[model samples]
Target chain A: MTIIPFPARSPRRYGDLVVTQPMALEDEADDVRSLAERLVAGEEAALEAVYDRWSPLVHTYALRALADPHDAEDVTQQVFVAAWRSRHTLTPSPSALPAWLIGIARHKVADVRAARARDADRLAAVVSLPGAHELHQSADEDVAEQLVVRQAVDEMPDPRRTILFLAFWEEHSHAEIAERVGLPLGTVKSHLRRGLITLHRQLEGVRHESR
Target chain B: MSHAEPDQLAGLALDPDDASEAVREHAQTCPECAALVAAFTGTRRRAGADALVAPPAHVRDRVLADVRAPAPPTAPPPVVVRERRGVPAWLAAVAAALALVAGIGLGRIGTGETPAPEASDPTPVETDDGGEVVAATALTALDSDAERGEASVTDRDDVITLRVRARDLGDEDGFHEVWLINVDGKRMVGVGILADGDDGEFKVPRHLIDDGYRIVDISVEPDDGDPTHSGVSLARGELA
Candidate 1:
């Protein structure tokens, strides 16, 4: 089992704790991008390769975002379709492949949300599922607690939040993040620096507020 | 690369001996710098925790299904031609004379009274119709008047085939060709040329398809070969 740590990169005055290295999940982003390019090229093998690589993650995200197994499955399918159709524009730069995919997933989630909006009762039913929002929030919390410093992260603007997610969630290097997000490396670093400061303040604020 | 360059020290761990003279002195007394050093020491820990969750299985099938769909038929009916098998000797001679006269008469248009050669030839070029037919079978049905079209998940294996057809591609020499797109219509890759009355086969890389994909399309192209497919879709289809 993976061990998630408490988010304190540098605690001022507490019992010292040794930090462990982060986990390496998979090289899914590049794999997905290459497969997407091939699939767009009309190569049958590309599709199969992509399916094998990221289906699990896609399904998980779909389930979490849509809160319906059937809808999750449908969204997963649509994500690939959107990826295939948009392959030409898919330059696997800063975001890498997985980040790009998550972006696609975000859009698909919005679409599912919009479609569900038409039916207030259905929307309410979806919202009423057992710990639905809590589940979603918890999963993110789990990831944050395990890998990223979430409370600090929650303080940034959308661009910074998005960029950081692409960097951390997708494990893209600074250069990779800059390229994928279409920003200069310097700009990316500045964002990171500012974001880190903001996150620190936010975390401290939460502690203060709670106290 | 084992040691972090000074410039790379934004958030990475730092080796003690490599610490600057001032930082080393600070570590000996000042608790703050010492703590920073310790924090830097364990920077690698962050790398392990940042992975996203995995997607489920069915997404894979849907993506591959869409990627393997074939190009749609977009051409007009084939032109008909008269048979030229057997004839009587006199009739043959008369036909030859008429042909000579027609040829001579047409020559006048080209400075020597020579008739211009007939532009349309009724011969069909050899193509992989079997593969194309299989591809067509995978698509949603086509309307009788549709000129350009696509088929989804027609056939698959390591390679997927898409069959594309066009009635009369006007000045298609430099046109942007065929492309396969993901569902969002943002990610895309070029497949091949959109030749008139011919099928275009796209080779999807096995890795990409394994994850998933959705739409396939063919378009009339101008010779200015940018990899971007002009949205002028001659044909399109969704994978089942």
Candidate 2:
């Protein structure tokens, strides 16, 4: 007689899945909500666990948005602390935790902007791509187009462009993007608008010349 | 060139498919809209690529560690442990022998019965990192009401007490302790151990109050008697 052996159950009973219950990416929203509750209750380990899972993404979003390594580091730390402090308001929902983090970073970016005025001018110098003067100097009209485009992107205000990057590249939803950048939901949409429009205007001469 | 409105262009910037249909249809009939759409689409495509950056791991760790540190516990005490008594003579003798076997065990456990250390006042330690000495400032604490929820502090002439509500402590070894460090940079001492709970109190050292020190550092420490900072700071306070 042939006998079928039942799979052994995991000692931790999280749910029906006997072995380690793996959270699909889709389930991350729920996971984050639960983690938030634990964090609100002063569970340091829970906060640490949440941080380990999501900080990399937050760091990357901040690094790209703020466009400075040091600023990104500061912003990432601020984002986690802010999340912990405000965790009590977290409502369990379908939105992923990363989205919430992105929101927190948004406000943090604004705080950084308000705190560091000197850094903005410094960032403008480095972040601004070669401009019309450089194009005129190089005397390579073909190269000038690319330079012009870069200059246009660089001209975008700190963090508006950063917000765009987080939304467009990171694929964060509007609410997520809004929270991370510290803009009102409507304002976030406007920045995306203004940024895209400004870039188009800057690149118009290049596009016309190229065609 | 007459192209899409900036707001419409904004929508197109996000959803290229929608732009492809709406703007292209308009562009086919109108030359100006076509130029505007191309310019907008090209620019949007270009700017989207520069949005990626990765931070170093060590930097990430440092910032995150600072953030994860808990706010200082306030309110009433939550934990209490009295010396367990009524053990038989043989067992008590065995315990005493075991303490002797482990050289520092008895003194540490005996002291454990007393209140843990009080909070550390911020001493101006010239902390040098990478050859640059930074005026290391450790403030006793700031407790935003929203951050602390229901925690509060009770202060008398010599003893400082704190009450706190804590969560998620299952099968965890050791209690949280309160520590006091001198602001004058002369002393850093542990005044008493604090129990974790929704309503518990910690008794601080009177001498620490006598000295001009008024900062509190609370940490979750293991029962092990190692006198080193575990780097796990939870809550903090300062003398007003």
Candidate 3:
């Protein structure tokens, strides 16, 4: 099992960390912008691609907020439905996509909770289950950022994803991961590096977008 | 081509000391690689802490099913979700500017005569929505309704000058250049640079506007000398 502790990025000491290489950033940014444009143009494939990529993260948020599987499922469905209709308004940015979807999911979850409040006093149950702030922090921006990064890690393609799980979740070294996954030492290092780039790119984009 | 590959950069992210001297030196000087390493390093330790719980597979089917059927009237109407979840001030500025531009476009139609194009009148054009208009417009900052400049097409004695003026642009460490982007968003033609903030005049094949190159744009291009649009718009407006 991975360490449950949350770790923050160490402070940057040198170089212009804010100014990204435009060439590569634009390449990744273009893919995001084009997907957004296509979705706006009502291309159905874009919708499916968006769903497949982000549904797990959306579902996780719904589940955590509502704590009831049925309500979570409904909210997940409503968020995507709302996304399709309001697709025109989505900002054409990469990190904005997931963050946008999460915003919708938040709305749908609130609606479910509101409906529950109307029916009865579920306050006692909510208060007793974990800490009150934990439940309340479901809507917190920090939590959303965590889920966004977690989703990025989870969604990475295999070998990279598998390698990272071993590296981070299991605290395995490069050789350990290679031995366990039955790959050469060099191949494991390659996947590790690739995974690092993907995760960092996503993290930076989301942070920039959020800020 | 001198820049490092994404993979090499990623390797340097974890610990710069572990890297070879050449790679470390390269990353220290390259802002792009530095920015990338900065991005990669954050959230790395905490990212894998939480395992994802996959939702039931049927959820996808249900979402697709809802897409097929229109929402029932009882359901709350979907709100256009523009809550600015992750959009920065710069992008939001563009959104607001676009809205004001839309308002201005409508106003032009109301005050002008029949926008129909005369066969010889420099090819007046119509929008996709079928309203016609001349080829002059105020270029507004993409962030606000403030008019940063003006652009117009003038044909004097058969010389076509796409005269454009803009001011107070972003200081993006690049020279400013002008372009005529098509309404279709696919085609574009580069005009000359703004060249000292004066009302710069440029010439293009007059037929290009007739071919739907009606949007005037000013963009900041890096000294990279790429001669490409860079997809970086400083100020823009459709030819009204």
Candidate 4:
């Protein structure tokens, strides 16, 4: 079977959380595009709309990047406030606002780290922070792309969804998955191939979108 | 752009070292393909790399207040065109036009009537090249409301094919088979056996559809020499 765990996963399922609704990612893409348009058109309420939909994402991402919860919250606030202030000039695609916000988040994160490094006392505090020195610029860049990916996978329908979960998260071999899911080995391989392609398209779509 | 196919890009991303020489050469030469390969590499690395955490609610109130409170009053706000998600301006015109004619308006004709031709398949990840979907149905597990998979009837040229996608049907000692049962419930035709994965295509005769065999079923059949349906259905659906 050609179902090699593409990125070489951790061989661990995050949690057995139940997905109550299986949504169409296309519908979501359309909705996000509209929200982006609204934000660009200077709708103040649209910012709240954007927040209701994605505040948690930005907050969690910021929190992950900055060791301090308060720093993360500050970054999240700056990112949205900056997005609103620059609404007139912003031209990110409908499917791309998340990526754009992420772009802003990255900058805010860098600024926070930079400011901390510039001050010796704060630098001492930073040195004492948990896993602060372990942070790398490359992993920070990957935050948005990873969130987009996890969202797409969660939104994926069954069979393919379950198959991908097994291969990536659970690190199951084709033979093991075939036996476990009672599918033919070939079908599992096909599912993986198709699922991977769909994911590539989603990622490409976000990157290539001009507005 | 002289870009490669999605399958090839995916193949390269999935196993870059194993990619063909031609794919590698093209990727090296074409900027778009190279970028896509890079993007795919990133995608793979990012897919489920970590679980996301939602922030607490107190942050929401603070973030909202910070943006609106600090208003620079010196420069007046620019004239902004608001585009809300509510009813469109043209919708009012269309409604008025519909009211004028006591009958159905021409504008109302194609609004919800026809499914548009797609530039590409958005989801479902299935690879069916050119066959047009004639009829489709969702299969549910037998004796329960749980969805199993979907089946679609497609017509390419003059041939009609039945595509069944079954999921998590659970392993049984007996084989899982596909069948088309007529409405009367007595008459049925054994179409084909379901393979593993999501899709199974069985080319059915044209007359069978016209004869009212609209019910698609996947049943568990025993290894016993009985040529009949084992009477235990794993999943079934009606193609409307």
Give me the candidate number with maximum TM-score: 4
Q: Is candidate 1 or candidate 3 better by TM-score?
A: 3
- Candidate 1's residue-wise lDDT over A75-170, tens digit each? 778877666656555554322344455557666776877687656677777666878656655564333223224423432467798776676556
**Can you list the residue pairs that collide in candidate 4?**
A33-A94, B165-B198
Candidate 3, B150-227: lDDT as tens digits = 776655444455777677786778888887755433356788898876468677776776666666778887776455
What's each prediction's TM-score?
0.33, 0.30, 0.46, 0.47
lDDT of 3 by residue, A1-211 (tens): 1111101112232232233233223433337667676566555567776787778788877777778888878888888878887887777877778878887877787678767865777766665678754556544555566777677767677878888888867778778889899999888888878777777667667656644
Ranking by lDDT: 3, 4, 2, 1
Q: Tell me the lDDT of candidate 2.
A: 0.49
Task: Write one digit per residue (lDDT tens) for candidate 1, span B123-229.
Answer: 12223443222222121112223343333222343354544443433344455365554432224556677554445555656433333233444555554433334
lDDT digits (tens) for residues A1-211 of candidate 4: 0010001112122231121112221224447666686677565667877776666667777887787898987888888877777766666565577767777787898898878788657777776787765555657656666776776776578888888888877878778999988999878777776788788777766656522
Write down the lDDT of every candidate, Cα atoms only: 0.45, 0.49, 0.65, 0.64
Query: DockQ of all candidates, in order?
Result: 0.10, 0.11, 0.18, 0.13
| CA lDDT for candidate 1 | 0.45
lDDT for model 3 comes to: 0.65
Off by over 4 Å in 3: A1-33, A114-135, A138-143, A181-187, B1-41, B49-51, B71-240
Give candidate 2 regions above 4 Å deviation. Answer: A1-30, A118-211, B1-54, B67-240
- Residue A51 miss distance in model 1 (angstroms): 2.7
